[model samples]
Target: MTQLETAMAILMKVFDTYAAGEGKPDTLTKGEAKTLLEKELPGLLKAAKNQEEVDKMLKGLDFNGDSEVDFSEFVVLVAALTCACHNRCVKK
Candidate 1:
């Protein structure tokens, strides 16, 4: 597979792995989201400065107000982070 294809596959796998933990298998509950962020993006969580900030981030990610994150929402989070990192690197 191409690099982008591999990345997409990895994203799906990661979401599936975490989403399978509890609740519906297709979406992430708050607890599952927290675990996924804590384990998968520890650096991002650490940079948040406080638990409230992290909570706010999670709330923002739930764009549909469904109290859970579906795959599309998760992709937005990943894409936003990727953009932020890319911008930072480009500025240097």
Candidate 2:
């Protein structure tokens, strides 16, 4: 599959696991992002080594500086990560 398609699939999988049977779309709430940083990305997201660190990181990615992160921003963030991990992955 293409990188864009692969990234979307990975992101959807991540969101599904986070939603935990909620059937919710792939949107990232503040809490969900924090959990992802602290738990799922332990080594990758070790800014301050805690939830507060994750919150700070979230602020930077929120773009509009809004308290919550919508799917658009979340997708961008996930795409960036995918690209970082797999150099040629995800076309943005």
lDDT of each: 0.96, 0.69
Report the CA-based lDDT of candidate 2 relative to the real structure: 0.69
Instruction: List residue ranges in candidate 1 displaced over 4 A.
Output: none
Question: Which pairs clash in the backbone of model 1?
Answer: none
Pairs that collide, model 2: none
Model 1: per-residue Cα lDDT at residue 4: 94
Residue 78 shift from truth in candidate 2, angstroms: 2.3
Error of 1 at 92 (Å): 6.9
RMSD, model 1, all Cα superposed?
1.0
Candidate with the greatest lDDT versus the true structure: 1
**Cα TM-score per model:** 0.96, 0.58
lDDT of 2 at 72: 74
The regions of model 2 sitting more than 4 angstroms off are: 1-7, 19-26, 47-52, 85-92
